[model samples]
Target: MSLRSGSFPRTFHASLQLLLTRRFGTFWLASLLSNIGTWAQQVAQPWLMLSLGASPWLLGLDTFALGGPGLLLTLLGGVLADRADRRRLIATLQSIQMLCPLLIVGLLLHGSIQPWIIVALSLVVGVTDALSMPSFQTIVSTLVDRRQLPTGIALNTTQFNLSRILGPSLAGVLMASIGAVGAFAVSAASYLPFIAVALWILPRATVQAVAPAEGGRDGPPLAGARAVLAQPALRGAVLTVLGGSLLCSPLLTFCPVLVKTVFQADVAQFSLTVSAFGAGGLLGGLLLMAVDPARDRRPLASWAASGFAAVVLLSALNPWAWALPLLFVAGGLAMTMANASANAWLQSQAPAAIRGQTVSLFMLAMRGGTALGGLLTGLTVSAWGVREALALNGLLALLALAGVRRGWLAVPRPTLAG
Candidate 1:
């Protein structure tokens, strides 16, 4: 955690060098802008739903709709990532995703928008995103050398976290000035740059055919899942992430419900709360960039999970508007660090042939747990208030942590890999 360490400068320099490269740099910028747009839509959509008199359950259902498809399709997406042209695959899927926000914009302008309509459109976006994300996640390996892959991923995470900050903040301004319609419009426009980059800016990131793994290129979609579970380190990381997503992630999903119902707050407060989490996530990404690339990330991930659980507990027990942002900051930092460390380790360890499938499994644990958590939490919130619901969720996360700790702790320490 010390920035004064001698190796920090070299690690930081390495990270910077990777980011400055043309292929990765262009993709990073595009992804950042697109993520910002996505986050803006995230903020606007939930607020719009709340404004339409949606209940906590409906809000949760909307989040589930946006993430649920990953459970069913993410592994298949991985197969496509490994066997298909990743660049074209991402470009095409994202173009489809872009339509979801545009549809919302059109519906809103026409006064025909409803909460269910938003949920339905979210399901559409989720499906495309589920299929595209594995390819997108694996693209970093193609852009940067294997040695620098961890740093590249850390930088990639940095852009996403940065968008988390800027996007919600931008949404706040736009919503205050022109309403959710403006936010939705910006979200739609954000996809264009990334689509352009995938199609043209990075040629090597594209691949026409992939070498088969242990199985043929056309092997079963769940083959990757089996291989991942067979490895102690991979299995542990995925399971930990499942608990993290199921318990901690819903806090972000239901932020509007918490602010409006618990604090009697407005969009500005909601934006600030989400932005605080994003700021912490950005810091976590930066910290990861400076970590020694050769170090074992498993311990770091475990400690982060523990810290994240504590923060979740604090948020529920404290439950004050003034303290919410600080708790959220800590929560975001810990969770981002945990997830990113696990991600870097997975990408580094998995073989090239199954890399896409491996990443898809990670996405499944993350997105699927988040989706299910949102739905369950929504039901809980409807029955007992947000505070009580979060308290229970936090406790459950701690218990789940205890159950999964052995899998990660038993992982053999890793050496530097190229």
Candidate 2:
């Protein structure tokens, strides 16, 4: 079967059904709840900064606070994943994640809230995420049979996009009905079910044996980082992740600014824009889930890249406010499909022992790229203007596509079931 043609054999549905029937369904529900809270906080935090009289530089700094730690800490977390129990690590990190929102809530309740406080709390959340993400990616294989790994990844992206739909709209409503503090409190409360879910999951049988360090070296965490950076495929994956992040991740950060400054719309309009984007992302996720990775990887990646660049360029044209929903549709589909495809490919190609490290590298590239993109966009908005800055972003995205076409990045063929 030609992967580019999009036809799948019978085995695809059978494997997908087996995956959906297991504990994976329960896990997906829990993840959805937790992800909603995370997304709510993501929307609230930037708004909080804006309310506190922050400048564009300060706003960019806020983005850095939320993503910079992943660049600094994910590699170390990956090394730990190779050496420890991933489930336990995730549980502990989730517990730490709970503290971030609670801290924000306390500050809000006391009327001590400030931009710096939001920045500090965002740093804490980023730290926990850096530690948690790698282990989380590595653990999915343990939750389901290998044949269903792609399905599991697609479903995970689907749930996250679902949360993207729920979180921003809910945050807007909560902020209007109560206040930012109330939104933070709800976000804190959402963490409890995830904690419960983490504890309740039955431990799976260990699949891969841990290998000792080479030459019994017992060196620092940097050794594993060096090893991963040395591999050509891993390096390409990391760069691809960076490219995707630069093109896509800034939408969430800039949406409020776009709604407020460019559209001259209120909070409700902002919420609708976010929801529309999430709806598009949800559609992309479902479309990806329905397809067979072995038969769809290459063309999906190519299509997603080109589509993302095109949508970004079109969005930059500054269409009428009535066209916001269409913009969201384009942005959402481009973001989710491109990201999910890259993630699936990365996870499949990574060696079992270094899977966590490899994933961490990917996460680092993403976070780093987002941080840089947010900063640059903020500056460009202050200087050239929003439309021009967005156009520049689209141009950069097109450049990334050229890189992919030139073989600077390669998506590997998906493995088939026996």
User: Pick by TM-score: which candidate is best?
Assistant: 1
lDDT of 1: 0.86
Candidate 2 residue 201 C-alpha distance from true site, Å: 2.7
Could you tell me how far off, in angstroms, the CA of residue 123 lies in candidate 2 after the best superposition?
0.8
lDDT of 1 by residue, 1-418 (tens): 4456688888898899888888889999999999999999999998999889888999999989999999999989888887777878888889998998999899989999999999999899889989999988988988876678789889998999999999999999999998999999999999999899888754644433433333326566567567777877778888888999999888888778778878889999999999999999999999999998877788888778778877877887885888998988998899999999889888888767778888898899899899999999999989998888888888999888877887678868432121
lDDT of 2 by residue, 42-99 (tens): 7777777777888666677778777888878988777766666666777788888788
- What lDDT does the true structure give each of the candidates? 0.86, 0.72
**At residue 205, what lDDT does model 2 achieve?**
33
Error of 1 at 106 (Å): 1.2
Per-candidate RMSD, Å: 2.0, 3.4
